[model samples]
Target chain A: MESTADSRVPVLNGRRARNKHDKHQRIFEAASALFTGQGYSSVTTQMVAERADVGTGTLFRYASSKAELLLMVMNEQMRLTTRLGVAESTDAASPNDAIMALLQPQIHLSLAFPENTAVYQREILFGTEQGRYRTEALARISELEDAVGNILARFAQTHRIRKDIDLNGAARTVFSTLHMELIRVSLGRQDPQTLTATLASHIDVLLLGILDPE
Target chain B: MESTADSRVPVLNGRRARNKHDKHQRIFEAASALFTGQGYSSVTTQMVAERADVGTGTLFRYASSKAELLLMVMNEQMRLTTRLGVAESTDAASPNDAIMALLQPQIHLSLAFPENTAVYQREILFGTEQGRYRTEALARISELEDAVGNILARFAQTHRIRKDIDLNGAARTVFSTLHMELIRVSLGRQDPQTLTATLASHIDVLLLGILDPE
Candidate 1:
């Protein structure tokens, strides 16, 4: 009887673990779809629980409130984005190429998941909760800026960029250009192909002006 | 007695006119403050009227609803912007110079009225009734794009820009870069002088890459 009971305990534990994982994922997907499709302000926890087909109490087990759910969704998004971004850097030789590679996946993702992008963009601009989340969002933007700056700095040493130029500012400019283009595309103002081509052309312009003196 | 009646009529009419004008100005100022300091949805017409020390009926006379108030504010802003923008082109020599001149004043105004810029940015991004204002907003952006295109076309003909490059795409890129930079500055992310200098430097870079072989 003891041996049988011990064997059942492992089975029960495995089932509980799987159930917990499934519940968390259901809550996340429910929150993401609702928050992205409608404005975040309009979404509620009860609605999320109903959509996820989970009890309201079960929903609370995963996320304390709507804001916490949003944070969790964003956290999952960041993890995926970070992983994809790092993967893009693996084979890149120069910092410029690496940064371009990093941005390409993001651009594709932004296009593919425009609703998600919209939600996050608004969150970055208007959401008031400070501390860790704000820091994370700022860090992502800064990392991209630094990636561009690193390339420009190295290029400048060889006289590729203007010697007196502020590398950080230039990097920020590059990032800002890309960010705006993505927004414009999402807003239906510009075509995706044109946005991509313009981005490439602009980068070339920057490179030509910054390249080593002949 | 007839002369006394005539004098009274003019005095009453003058007072009524002054009261109406005062009410309108009060509503406008109150709405601007609330919209800037708080997100749009959070601000109520009652709050605005109270803040302005006016009756709710008085607020309705100036703006039918909060949405209308936003439209009115934006219209006034764009009118002022257009005046400043148009003035800059009058003394400019070339189309390129004209565009650069035109954008400068608008950029300066954005820096001065950061809150105004923020309100417009949010409205453009998420307002549901945006259809009512889309035409005018897009017309302004298109006008800027056209101005830039004309300059690039002329410059290309003179071998000032790359003869083979797509003028349309290049024009769009230029406008996008400038617009994004202005927003960044208004959001307090970039300093005015740095933005101004960076724009000039980037424009030079762009011209070099596109200009015909000299």
Candidate 2:
């Protein structure tokens, strides 16, 4: 009886964990589709729940609000993107280039769904959403920041970057450019090339001073 | 009879313009008070109109929406602040210092009314208000950018800055730092001292580069 009960408990726990993860994945897909296709505001939680084949109660249990729902979807993509960023930048020829490569995926993410991304950016930056998803997303963003800092630290080890410069602050500067360019691009008033050029130049300024070459 | 009609035309025209200007000032004060005291979302156009003692129709005539009302208040302050930026930055010794001085008042403005400023910034940067006030605000922002550009150009004249550098782009980089810091400050999650330190370092990176100064 003890052996049978122990075996059942492990199997039940594994199955339950898998079930929850699968449902979360469906919710992510459903939310992404609705938000990308119909935009963030027009889509309702009820719609996402139905599309995900989950009850509204189930959806709320996962994400307390639509903002949380949005964060959940973006946060998952960001995990993949952060990994992709590290891979892409690991072999960059210079610190500046490495940082650029690290951020290329993110800049494209903004360009891909500029509208929804703008709302996500707003919430993450200034929206008062207090959901755990936001907390996870914040942690995910910090992971990306750490990834950039890691690249910089690697360069500093090679004496390419200043050892004393705040790697974390510098990482923020890189993403600050990304955020500004992302917001500007979302206006649909500026070309996306401007985003790359401006970011490149900002990175250039950060690494190589604008002071006249003595 | 001709003389009487001509004299009355100047007096009557002067009185009408004065009345319109007076009402517009009243509207500005009323909107600023409501937006500041009660916050942007809580206050309605009707409340502003009533406070200003103007008809709601008249308020609508001046500002089509609440966003426009917010923009109107900010734009007026920005006009005065631009002049202050110039005066404050004119005598700075370095391009970076000059740039920082130019942006100080603007930063204070952001800090003082961060919540309203955050909304105003989100709208200006990404919101699709498309009102004349937004247009004016964009123009005003451009003027500030131009002011920063002009400061960089002034420094370049003495060969302190690289003449080859795009002053406009550099000005943009400066403001990009400001925008990011302002948003961070608005989150009220970071120390304001951190804002100055980050911006100063960003300016240092821009002016002095981050490579080991070998």
Candidate 3:
């Protein structure tokens, strides 16, 4: 009789876990669909919950805030882009080329959904240190920077990158430069192609240095 | 008869003008006090109006939104710092030094009011182009970028800077790098001094560059 009861409890627990996972997936898909190439300011969490067929309160369990909801969507993009970017970086022609390789896909990701990218970046840049999603977002950013650091370190070993510069510090600044340029895209000041070209030139300037060789 | 009617209208008009000016000043002062080093999300326009001793409805006439109110305060700060920064840049020893001189005060201005700066930047960075104040804010930013371009042009004329690079493009990229790093300060990852030092070093890296003397 105890064995029968225990077996019934595990079946109930399994169903609960599956239900929770399905709900999470629905919320995530809803956010991703709502956020894709849309003005983030216009997309309400209530709408996301409605789209997901979940109650608004239940949506809060998945993402505490709209910023977090965007994070939930963006963080996965971050992970995939970082993996793809790192892979591209490995076989590049030079240190500068490698760094560009690592960052190009990121640039594409950011530019693809300019609205969502701006909000996602705004949250990371200005959002306070709170909530689980922000922590995860920061972790993804950290992982990307570490990938940059590792790339720089590899180049430094081959004397392709300057050894005197701190690898991690340089990584942060390099990415900071890229991140800012990416944010500049949504300003409507420049066309995407012009902005991308200017950013490429800026990256080239960074590699070549602005000072004339003495 | 016409002179007497004109006299009455002028008296009323003068009082209206003075009332509007006084209320604007009050709202500005209230916002400055409320926003200084304070979490922007916590401060309400209602509180600002109350502190200014004006009705909340009246406050809307002065600033269309809280972001605009922050812009009103920060735009003044931006103008003052740019003037002082430009003066300092003229006496700097090198191109990099000149750029740093130009940006150092802007950095301090940003770091001094981390919360306000973040919001101000967020508005300018991501805010929709719909309001009068944001338009003014963008003009101020354009003026600042032009200043950077002017400085870069000066350095280029002396043959100290590379002539091949687009000064305006480089200036834009340079300031973008600084702005992003300034945003980084509010993340609670590093102290102000550490951040400043690292930023200075990053500027150095951008100047001296990463590739060995080619």
Candidate 4:
């Protein structure tokens, strides 16, 4: 009797879950299309609702506002690419391998979704209102900084870098420099292969400057 | 007498010039105030015209659109700073000295009118419908890039950098790195001095990596 009840409950919940997911997917697709065509400034919640074929209240249920919607879209994109993991140097024989791995995904992301990347770029450079969205964006960036810092820390430890070096500051510098280089590449001013080679060379210089003598 | 006629003509023309100048100043002040308070999207031309105490037609004659008005304010600010000649580093005895001089004014400006800076950031990251304004922004950036490139070229020559090194790419990398760094500083995640020092160190690495071997 207990097994029969459990089976019935899941079947009912499964249909409802599928429907909910389909609706959420529609909302995201609508937001992406509208934002790309009209930009963040011109698009309205009502427009998003209409495009998604949902009521305004339903759209609100999924995303509190347009800013939150934008963040969700970006977060989803990041998650998708992150799962693939970065393939830096197949040889794994070089000390610079870890730094190259850390930078590869970032460069690829900027190249992949230039529009969404621009959206995140604007939000970080100039924050939104004091709302849930702004808080989440700030939190997300902090998490990213921490992740990059952890990677750098591991690299330093494995390579026996100088104990006196300010690892946190070095991490931020590396992260910022890589991010800036990617933005320049996205600006359509430089070829990708040249940018990759130049950045990799610069990273080598920076690491050598601060590292302990091996 | 002929002297009387000449005096009358000078007085009349001077009065007319003053009147036009006054109107232009009023319009610009009004637009700047509105943009600072409500951002670029919330303000309209009618509101600016009303605040300036000018007719709608008069405002249109001065600026064709809201974006143009914002760009005009930025142009005026650049002119004021240019007249100050903040770019000079005549007594600098080293390449780093000259680079520091170039970067100081940028940090000061980023902190000064942060709102205006925010507007321009958005405009560049995402293209606006105002084609002329966007074009002007690109033109100004290219001019500034040229100045930075020339300075780097001179430094490379003096310091004996490698003959085969791409100075153009190196210049772009330097400028682009600093540009994003300034934006990061504005976002309140970084301390100004730390950013400056770290960037200086990064420049050292770049110089060391690219310099020709003795």
Candidate 5:
């Protein structure tokens, strides 16, 4: 009887895990639709719960507040964008091209939802310390930086990257430069194409120095 | 009689102008003290008005909200810092040295008041668009960028900066990079000396590129 009871535990645990995942997906979908439909400020948690078919308490359990929910959605979107961008850049001919390919998707995503992007930027830059989603956002950012670092590592193998270059530091600077460009784009100061060109120029300056090589 | 009336008008206008200047200074000093003593969020406009010895209405007239008041204090502080930094950098031996000299003072200022620096960074990057102080902040940033551009211009006259370089673009990039360094400092991720050194390295990469000259 003890052996039979122990064997049944896995089935129950698997069902519970699946239910939790389904509920999480439903909440994310509902929140995304509601947030994108009405502005983030106008939407309420109760409405999200109602649409998600979960108890308001369950929604709170998943996300402490509306801001956290927004961050969760953003994190998911960014992960998808990174996936697509990395896949697209696999065939990039050079390090600069790979860096651009990685960053271009993010710019396009920001352009697609400028309002959300602005809030995301503020949250990442200013809200990270106090927000519950800080860990998640930081993790995503580090992952993005790692992706850029990987490209540079690959480039370093074939080309002469500076001997004194700090790989992590260099990757971070590239990531930061891309972030600055996105901020410019979010501000309507640069369109996607203009940002791409400007970013390419900045990367050139980073790799080639502004002094004449001759 | 016409000459006497004209003389009286000038005297009245002079008194009014002097009063206005005095009140503005008092408010700035009061807000700065209060904010530095007890973080920004805890301090109120009412408290600021009382401390400054101005009416609450007058406080609002001078600064639309707490955010704007914080920005006003920051703008004043930054101007003073910039003046001192520029003065200190006057005899810098090279273009890079001058840029670092100009930036080091800012790092010192931020370290002196990390709390206020955090608020100022948020205000400048995320708060500018929505705040009443937007124009003032943008003008100040543009002025600083122009200062950097002027340095590059003077350097270019004697040195061989790449012909393809855009002086304004280069200046903006340098300004943006400094902004990034400060944000890291504000986050407690970097110390003043480390930030200064990293900024110098970043500037070297910007000016000389990461590739070998030989």
Candidate 6:
């Protein structure tokens, strides 16, 4: 076994890697379909495996359990949201605009898949399996938070915000405010359009606190 | 009922009211002990009924389910925190001091019952039974936020903050920040003392946004 790689099994290794990637993609698609169709709690791992056309063992190798699988889907969605949000924020003309651009994609994602969004929020905060995936999920969110912080730091450079402002803390505050707004929307306390508009106003108030006075 | 009143059953009615009050107290104590001892999910309605010496139907009459019971305990704890916080804040020398004083009791409560606090946070945010108790919890929390807003408004009267500052929004923002801080503590990401200190700093930043410039 130790001599296999030394004997030049690169082709075999490459094929195995491709197969693993394909299986992972199939499992993700299957899990997403099942979860969206029947909700997160009702869908079983066996069902996902059957739908993905993979062995149960193969599915387990991809994700430790159903909750981990759910987190995997969330991780992918968050990655996409962060990528799109950063791209959207690139053309922002001011700090508030940049903040809004960064958050708009996430709001759209939440609105587009309200059920999944609810599950994501619940799982992140309180799922029993949270300990297993908390680091991974937090890493993804930290990336988004850092993006917001970067935008604020850029504003500080331009003298829009106070030169001595704590960009990281301010960004966390902004992200937390948006988070509360999302919870309100998910709980049906507010509509999505209102959440978006209200978020803009909240950011304006946040900016008023952080930005240099006119 | 009117016929009974006309028949003059005043002594019987008084005894019945006292019995009902005692039963409510006993139920609250039993539910609190069992939830804390075995955790929320593991403790069943039957178990609570047995501990409280009440019928299952009676427990249902008190709280519709285990989740609701958890919320009931949380509701009581929050009421205590609010009352204590308000009392402490009455001696606050400034708006910032008042805000900190208001949040300190809550932080102490969270630290005292870390497990219960986690369950409370989760249930309030995402429990299925939340719909039943959301109005009640929101009403209680609104009173707290309103208290914070009123303090801010009082400060405005003294020119401590800008007169036109959105006190309600500012209060909400402040509350959200403390909420995030609490979540961090419940997740074991931050120590209680650090949370208290950091929250003070966050409130200072919040003040910067609303306070009149020097």
Instruction: Quote the positional error of residue A104 for candidate 1 in Å.
Output: 1.4
- The number of the candidate with the highest lDDT is 2
Give the TM-score of chain B in candidate 6. Answer: 0.80
Q: DockQ numbers for every candidate?
A: 0.32, 0.49, 0.51, 0.25, 0.44, 0.50
Model 3 lDDT vs. the true structure? 0.76
| Model 2 spans with C-alpha error above 4 angstroms | A1-27, A44-61, A160-164, A210-214, B1-26, B44-46, B53-61, B160-164, B210-214
Best by DockQ: 3
Q: Per-candidate TM vs. native?
A: 0.72, 0.82, 0.86, 0.72, 0.83, 0.82
Candidate 2 CAPRI grade: medium
Candidate 6's residue-wise lDDT over B1-214, tens digit each?
8777776745645887798887878889998898878767778889889989999999888777777887777788888888999999999998889988987888888887777777777666666654565558767778888998998778777766665556787788777777777887876767777777666766766766776676
iRMS (Å) per candidate: 2.5, 2.7, 3.3, 3.1, 2.7, 2.1
Ten contiguous residues with the weakest lDDT in model 4 chain B:
B82-91
lDDT of each: 0.69, 0.80, 0.76, 0.66, 0.77, 0.77
Candidate 4 lands at a TM-score of 0.72
Ranking by DockQ: 3, 6, 2, 5, 1, 4
Q: What is the lDDT of residue B181 in candidate 5?
A: 72
| Residue A135 lDDT (model 5) | 69
lDDT (Cα, tens digit) per residue for candidate 4, span A15-99: 7889899999999999888876766667899999999999999998887767777876666666544433334433345546655
A128 Cα displacement, candidate 5 (Å): 3.8
Runs off by more than 4 Å, candidate 4: A1-25, A29-47, A86-91, A95-97, A130-167, A177-195, A208-214, B1-23, B33-45, B54-67, B82-87, B128-137, B160-164, B192-195, B212-214
Runs of candidate 1 exceeding 4 Å displacement: A1-30, A33-42, A49-71, A93-97, A126-128, A157-159, A212-214, B1-43, B48-68, B93-97, B126-128, B212-214
Residues forming the 10-long window of minimal summed lDDT in candidate 2 chain A: A205-214
